[model samples]
Structure formats: structure tokens, C-alpha cells
Target: MPSGRLPVVNPWRFETNQATVQIKVGTYYSQVWTRAINAWNSKKVFTFKIVKGPAQITILPAQSNEASLIKQNFVGVAYVNHDNTKRITSVQLHLVNSLLKSNGYTTSQRVNVAEHELGHAMGLAHNPSKQSVMYKTTRYVSIQPIDVKNAKDLYSIPASQYFINLPATTSTTANKDVIANGAGDRLFKSPFETRSVQALVDPSTIY
Candidate 1:
């Protein structure tokens, strides 16, 4: 169990501290994901096993309108799908190459974004502190001590204790829509492209 105060835990999580991951991005981005995985694995609070077939977490390049996302300054996004009991079934992390390239984000910065999204997949909410990788705009940060502590603390709790009886329409039907139709809660937005927007407090921020 966590020895200190707990960080914010998302309503969903894997059954354990480890999860299978599959990366479907380009070579460069694949390396970025790999580095991100290694960074988190170094923490030893959680583990991500690489797999070829269906995986609990899938990381892929975003196929959305690049121009629109660039305009919005979004670097990446994560969608989480869970069962009725709020156990996360699958997570899809989409990295925006167009935005990353156009904005001239360095390789390390891109890796930071990947780490941030992966944190969401591990059941972490955005941290208000800018020093943590789970912050809403996390391109400038790496996984900090708070991040490791939060992840370790979250997994220490029993899965059953996290369950909440959400409305049937939102929990059941909405989740099916997410798995089948790809319409679900957008759990995280990696980083904003423009520094101006990043400076402001976003009320709808989730990652």
C-alpha cells in the first residue's frame, strides 16, 4: 500500500500493475514509444510488456485531420474503454505526428508526450504540478517522483474498492460505443503546440 498521501487515481485501471502493449506507429514514433516504455519501466512501479496481437494498450499515430489538431495545438490523445465494473479493458493512444513535426518538437519532447499518455493508460489523472509527467501539458516534463509514487499507490489498492456504480446509460452503452464505434472518453491530451495556450489554465484539461 502507499505510505504517503495518494495522488489522483482515474476511475479505471488494469486488474494488475502490468499490462500488454502494442505499438503501431512509424519507426521513429515506435522508438519514441519504446523509450517511453523504458522510462516508465525504470520506475518499477508498473510494467508494459510488448506484444504483437491484441493488447490491453495500443499506441498508434493519430489519423485525424492534422490541420485541425495543429490548430488546436494537441500533440496526442488517449481513449480508455472499460467494463461495467470500471475495470479498464483497452486503451488507445494516438500520437499526432503532424503537430509534433510542424511544431518542431524535439525527440525528447515527443517522448515526454508518449510518457504522459502512457501514464493515463496506467490509471493516472493529470497532476496540477507542472513538474510531474502526468500534468495536463507534459511535453516539458519527464516522469517525476510524484508520478512513480502515484502509480505505485494506485495499484496497491484492491480493484473492487475502486468500483463506482455509474449511470447505466453512460457506463454500459457508452463503453460499448467506445469499443465498437471508437467514441468514448478522451482521457488525455498530451500537450499544446502553442506556448501561449499552454500558459493558460484549461478547465477541460484531463491529462
Candidate 2:
């Protein structure tokens, strides 16, 4: 399976098995982004749908200057937003049109960059293997077994925390009802409060 440098804290992950991505109707590079989305959806690990409204993931076109500001020589990139506890809330991906053109990338190569950025948006890190789409510098146009294995492993690991602001009375009432019913409250709730938790095997071992 693909391997990568672990973040200082556990990586954030999507709450659901499926995610919605938004692309502007007439955005430049829309074709390549569509091809990339199809490439990822071909895998069974998760499904990605395109929507016209707000979405968990948003893909946009960028200029060569914007791409360079984010990272030198980057043709595409993905960014994730997380709370203090490391739960992923949103992701944004950018594709540099000028950079791709300057690099002399063909349609297939643009798709490869899109696929790689999407992998990062889905909590995938840079894999060392050249055959994997998550490689630091992508050489593959399609997702591979290493990519699939790593993605599945990530989803298998549960969130490390759930921090919701609730009124004291309502929070207490909810907890009481949960415990009274013998539900799995102990794993994530207390009689009158909620707290962060470290659940299950380490993500590194899931693979």
C-alpha cells in the first residue's frame, strides 16, 4: 500500500463515505476536472458527485502566479480546513491552467494532476511509490491498489474528537436519555458532558 509522512496530529477525514464537489459551470479546465472526478469514482472506496450549489469540495482554476504562491512549480493543489482537534470540515482544490500549459502537459497529464489533488483533498498524503496516484509527484493517471488501500485505511479510523457547543440543560438531558437507553454513549458521551476521545487502532496500522 502507499505510505507517506504522518502529520504531527492525526489527519482529518470526511464524515461520510461519499462527498459532493462543486465546479463552476464554465470554469476553465472543467473538462480535465471532470475526467479526474471520473477517474476517482471508478474506485469502490468512495463516490464523488458534482453539484451546482455549495459543496464539501470545490475545484477552481488558478493562474500560474497563484499556483507559485501556494507552492513553487505546483500545477495543482488541495487544502483542508480543520478544527483544533483535527476534524476535517472543508477542502478546496486548485488547478493551475498556465502552469500546466507551460509544462507542456497533455489532456491526460492534466487529468493526472487533478486526480492527485483530489486524493489529497480526501485525506490522502504523498505516497513514495510512483505507481500510486498519491505520489508526491504524480506519474500515474489512474488510482492504483496502493491508493485504494490507503484510502480505505483512512476511513476505517474514526474521528478523534467531537466538539459541539450545547446548552448545559439540553446536553445533560441528551446524555441521560442515551445512558438510560443503554446506547453507546459511554464511547462518546458522559452523563452530563462530552469529551474528546482516541478511538480504535492507530491509522497507520489500519492498512
The top-ranked prediction according to lDDT is 1
Count residue pairs with overlapping backbones in model 2.
0
TM-score of each: 0.77, 0.68
lDDT for model 2, on a 0 to 1 scale? 0.59
Task: Give all candidates' CA lDDT scores.
Answer: 0.71, 0.59
lDDT of 1 by residue, 1-207 (tens): 656576866766788999999999889899999999999999999999999988999987666564655555567777666655566767888777766776677899889988988988888877779898877776678999999989988888876676555532222322211111111223322121100111111223334
Error of 1 at 102 (Å): 1.7
Global Cα lDDT for candidate 1? 0.71
Q: Note the clash tally of each candidate.
A: 0, 0
- Tell how far residue 12 is off in model 2, in angstroms: 1.2
